[model samples]
Target chain A: MRLSLGPLLYQWSRDAIEAFYAERMADPVDVVYLGETVCAKRRSLATDDWLALGRELAGAGKQVVISTLALVQAGSELATVRRLCRNGEFLVEANDMGAVRLLADAGLPFVGGASLNLYNVAALRLLRGRGMVRWVPPLELSRDDLGDLLGEARRAGIVLETELFAFGRVPLACSARCFTARHVGRPKDRCEIVCEDYPEGLPMASQEGEPLFTLNGVQTQSGAVQHLLGHGGALAELGVEILRLSPQPAHMGEIIGRYRAALDGACAETAVDRWVTAPLCDGFFRGAPGMAAAPDP
Target chain B: MKLVCPAGNLPMLKAAVGAGADAVYLGFRDDTNARHFAGLNFSDGSARRAVAHAHERGCEVYVAINTYPRPAGWRRWQRAVDTAADLGVDALILADLGVLDYAARRHPGVRLHLSVQGSATNSEALRFYADAFGVERAVLPRVLSMAQVERLCEDSPVELEVFGFGSLCVMVEGRCLLSAWTTGESPNTEGACSPARAVRWVESAGGTEVRLNDVLIDRFAPGENAGYPVVCKGRFTVNGATYHALEEPTSLNTLELLPALARAGVAAVKIEGRQRSVAYVDKVVRVWREALDTCRRSPEAYTPRSEWMATLASLSEGAQTTLGAYDRPWQ
Candidate 1:
């Protein structure tokens, strides 16, 4: 199976982001998703910069996909998405229906991002008709749910690629309010760029002191990283065309390397766990709570 | 502007219609709708009665089959659309693209309103729904500021509806997975969030603790008001301080924005509580209906009455309310 790097959900310094991508130019990942999927206020990389980066990655033989904002509320945001859809050089990931409409109207083939919430074969078929080439199901779907959907799609003669969010902190929700700013007692409009400080997002814990969620601007992600290195074989068996590993602050290259090695049969699938420092979970894969971890196979 | 109120059952439907609701929205008893709560929503017989009752009062009935249909249960959602259309409801409030496609093709005469769970926040998205499925009205998710809403009202190809009063959802509807991440059930798949069967409330010496699937969502101190243990509204610790990191336990009350909404030519205002009691449906719908009437009579002279505001406040979640994302500062 091919390995892909998901979009960066956290806000980092421009230099840090550029340097991160520079390092990924030689990483084992075959595909890379570029652009901001969270708050529009995050301008670490402007639209031109993202396009430049995509070209650099594309030149290096890695497939590049431009990811759009998951929540499109403002006219300016919609305009930005329109520009991204018209970026002729690379495929765009439509996170919301606005982007989907723009890309579909242009007859540009795109990836249906996880936030599109495709839960059934019929939804998949509709997007396919709209020129969607690949789809990332919402993070909450189980392996069985996906298997059933894909099975139905096959029976219905629908053809499209499937990408699974196999690793990193699972995005749990997105809101208009910037939780990162709110945590520091600042309004979303007048707030300083507080999200830049937390490269992996500000960690939040429950009342009883258990790690719960990661507050990254307007998005809330699971505090524990979702590790699916152990499911490479299962994913391939289920006809998963791509495995998406989200970017983290550190050890991303190493994580990508381990996934490559595991997929290549050079190492055991569970060996990648050594590179993931945070607690790991794969509950959604087993049809259980996402925070619950299934025992390693 | 039209006032669309939620009704989980027949009594709530009658209550909303009696309270001057222009339309009443409800769901089937099964998982086809977003408010698929036990002992809530209507069975086929009750749904028929609800439509007849609201029709008698000159109120429209909209059936919400808003939840995304699972592939295994896709037939159920299609059945719901056919049943609602068969019952002669005014419209079908839908979110799933597959279901919308089915409804538009099979029930050409029935109107289609895009549910808030559809997550269409821009004119382009609205246009896509209108062009593809003939959606007549699109409910905006509670994520846009007032300026954005006004811009949409001017640009949208279809009619626009905004949430007026309800328990607020901090996350964008249909996209949020926080509840599923914790409970393995979600509104998109199962039509429930923090499903009641997984909830546990324990009174302890320190306080009253509410847990979702044994995860401590929030703890209320003695005499502190306790709200439902929704994952978003729960208190959590960030850095070293404990606070409502996402949002507090509150409701969205847009009474003060009635004049502005009316001036913007908003097609309708929706009150969102299909899971609430019949009394809540009556009181909240009455307050919004009066506010809408006053605003329509004189947009320049309209002001929310203190009595209406007080009644809404008392009925709000946690007995408190805010303008939500409509006000710039709230974001």
Candidate 2:
């Protein structure tokens, strides 16, 4: 399976974003998802800037896909999705149905994001008919669940490239109220883009001081980083075509390198467990509470 | 605007209809719906009687088959849709794309309404559903502002329904995983949040400590009135301050927004307590019925009354209410 860099879900300065991608030119990732999938107000990189970067990345022999916002609440947000779908220069990852309809109506082949809730064969076939080429199952799907879905899809004669979220803190929830802004006692609209202060998001802890979650503006993420490197061989055996690693502020290059080694038949020798700063969790793949961490088989 | 109420059983269904509900929504006695609480929902026999009772009272019954079905349970969801149709229910409230495809193809004549779990927050998403599955109405997620709701109602290809009152969900429905993160159950996959089986209320030195699968959600002091242990509404420390980091334990009471919603061309107002008692459904439905009638009779001179607020507040979660996301100051 190929390693894919998922969309940047946090806010960062334009210079930092550009410099990060400039270094990604030499990374082992096959596909790089560009554009912001979180809050729309995060305009560190504009639409034109993203297109320019996408062209630059493609020219460097990298496959690039522009992603739309996961939550489109305003008309302006919808307009942004339309612009991304009509870019004509790059394939778009449709995160919501609005983007899906726009791409399907334009007859453009697109990739469906994890939040689209495509859980069954008929839905997959219907979207494939509507020009969907690849799909990322919802993050909550376990190994057994995905195995059954992929098996069913093959039986139905529809080919879908499957990408699984393999690393980083799993996004647990989203809302209209921005918790990052609310954390500082400011309203969503009046807050002066406080999310930029948190490159990895602010940490939410239990009353006993145990880290529980990360509150990124409107998005709540798991406190434990989901590390599936131990199951790299199992995922490949399950027909997963791509493994998605969400972008973080630090040590991403090293993280990608470790995953590449694991997929190349390298045995995880307990050193891979220390890759992420946070505790590792793989229980969701074992059909248990997502926060529980089981020993690598 | 039509008044839609939730009923967990035949008695609640009859109570809602007698209390002047225009439509009553329910789910089967399994994990086919979002409110898959123990001792809740209807059996096949009870569902048939509910449809008959609602139809006789000039009301409609809509079965909620809104949970996302994995491959193992996909046929079970299809069976639910087929059974609801066979029972002569007016509409099938659904969220899964495959289920919608199955319902549309197998039961063409049955009306389809998009459940709140569909999470279609904008007009374009609504248009996609209308084109794909012929969805007649969509229950809006609680994440939209009043202005956004109004714009959607004006331009949506299908009729729109907004939540009128219930225990508030801080995160958008069908998109949250806090429940499954702590407990292995979610509204999307397992059809429940913080499933009762995983919950424990232990009286501690401090007070009652509520835990979900050994994860301490919240602890109440003496006489602090502990609430249900939903993961989102639990207390957490952020920046050294312990508080309801996501949202406080409160109910969403949109009775005050009735006139504005009616003027926005909203087709229906949905009351949201499927796990509640029949008396709770009866009282909440009656208040909304009277409020909607008065608003319809005189749009210009309508005003919210203190009695309506008091009655709703009395039965609300945490014994308090807020016009969540409707008149939210932070939108």
Candidate 3:
């Protein structure tokens, strides 16, 4: 299985973002997705900067893909998506249908990101006809659901790389309202870009004080990190060509190294769990509640 | 602009039609639709009655088979499309591309309106649906502002529909997994959010605590009216402050913007509660119908009457309403 780094979902300073990607260039990840997938207001790195970083990553022998915004509401956002699709240098990850259509109209091959809901084989088949070379299934899909979809795809004679979200705090929802700005008592328009304060996102808890979600600008993420290190064999068996690890604040290189070790059979799958700081959850993979952690087999 | 009302059963369907709904949208009694609540939605027989009643009154009937079908349940969604078409419904509102593809090919003559759950926010996405599946109309998600909606309507390939009134979905449709994170089901996969089966309302010493699968969504103080326990609307602690971190319990009311919507060429205004009561359908549809007719007659002189606004607000979640994302400041 190949290791891929998903786009940065948090807001960081341009210097911090450059340093992070520069560090990631030496990491064991094979494919790197660069661009802001959360809030469009985060201009720590402009479109040109993202393109440059993508080129730098490609120069470091990493297959780079640029991801578009998950929710494109304004004409300007749509225009940004168009510009990204026209960037012929790197493969584009179409996060929303608008990006998908732009790429399809241009007849460019693209990766259907997790935000684009492809629940069944027929939907995947439709996108395949539109120049989609690979797809990351929705984060809510279970192992059984993924297995069923792949099985149907095989029966229908459709071919595309399957990339699964293997690690990170899974994004639960994206809203037009910025939760971070709301937390700081500001409207989304004049909020002064407060998301930069929390590089890992502000944590939210239930009334009982249990971790519930993380507020990352317009995106709300799972409080518990999704740890699928133990599912390496299952993923391979199910024909997942790539495993995507979302960029976190710390230990991303170490996390990538451990995933590489696990994939290479140099280490036990369970041993990789020690590196994850938050509580572990793989319940969505087990067709159960997302916050639930299934017992190890 | 047309006023599309929601109906869960035969009575609500009749009520909407009788109350001046230009079109009525509903779902089957299974996971084929987003409002897949227990004891809600229409059965096969009730759906046929709904179609007949709405059609007889010159109102169109739309069957929403909008959920993303898993491979194991693909045939169920296809069968729903076939059944809805065979029943002679005016349109089949669909979200899944595969389902849209199937409905377009199998029922070539039937009109297809893209459901809001499709999450096609831009003209390009609408063009994709229109070109790929021949979708006749598309419902824009509630994420867009008034200006964005106007911009999209200017260039959209298909007729545009926007939510005029409803309980607000804070997140973009088809993208929210908050319910699935707390429980195991979501509107995308299971066609339900915070599925009623997993909900528990406990009376505690402090207040009435509402929980979804034992996750405390909110605790209401004595005499505080509690709304449905949608995960996003729940109060939670964020950065040492407890509040409605995402959104408060409220509804979207665009009654005042009817003139602007009409001027923007919005083809339809949708009322968003199939899970609500027959009275809600009757009352809200009547109010929107009157407002829309008044707006159509004199767009320049259009102003929503206070009585109509009062009625809608009285029926809204938390007994309040906002312009939602339509107003720039709401975002």
The best candidate in terms of DockQ = 3
Instruction: Give the per-residue lDDT digits (tens) of candidate 1, residues A1-297.
Output: 999999998999999999999999999999999999898889989999999999999999999999999998888899999999999899999999989999999999999999888888878888999999999988999999899988889899999999999999999888889998899889999878899989999989987888889999899999888988787888998889999999987888889988889889998745556666568899999899999977745
Candidate 1, lDDT over the whole model: 0.91
TM values, all candidates: 0.99, 0.98, 0.99
Q: Can you list the residue pairs that collide in candidate 3?
A: none
For model 3, state the Cα shift of residue A288 in Å: 0.5
RMSD of each: 1.0, 1.2, 1.1
Query: For model 1, how big is the CA root-mean-square deviation?
Result: 1.0
lDDT of 2 at B265: 94
Query: Which runs in model 1 stand beyond 4 Å of their true positions?
Result: none
Angstrom error of the Cα, residue B271, model 1: value is 0.7
Q: How close is candidate 1 to the true structure, as a TM-score?
A: 0.99
Per-residue lDDT of model 2, residues B1-331, tens digit only: 8999999888899999999999999999888999998889998988988888899879998999999999999888989999999999889999999999999999999999999999899888999999999999999999988988899988899999999999898888889999999888889988999999999998978788888898888989999977888988899998899999998889998877788898899999999998999899999998888998888898788887889889999998788998888766844
Candidate 1 C-alpha lDDT tens digits along B1-331 = 9999999888889999999999999999988988889999999999999999999889999999999987889999989999999999999999999999999999899999999999999998899899999999999999999999999999999999999999899889988899999999999989999899999999999889999999999989999999878999998999989988898889999999988887887999999999999999999988888788888878899889999989999998888999999998888
List, residue by residue over A198-243, the lDDT tens digit for candidate 2: 9988899888887889999999999989988777778988999999
On the 0 to 100 scale, the lDDT of residue B225 in model 3 is 92
User: Candidate 3, overall lDDT?
Assistant: 0.92
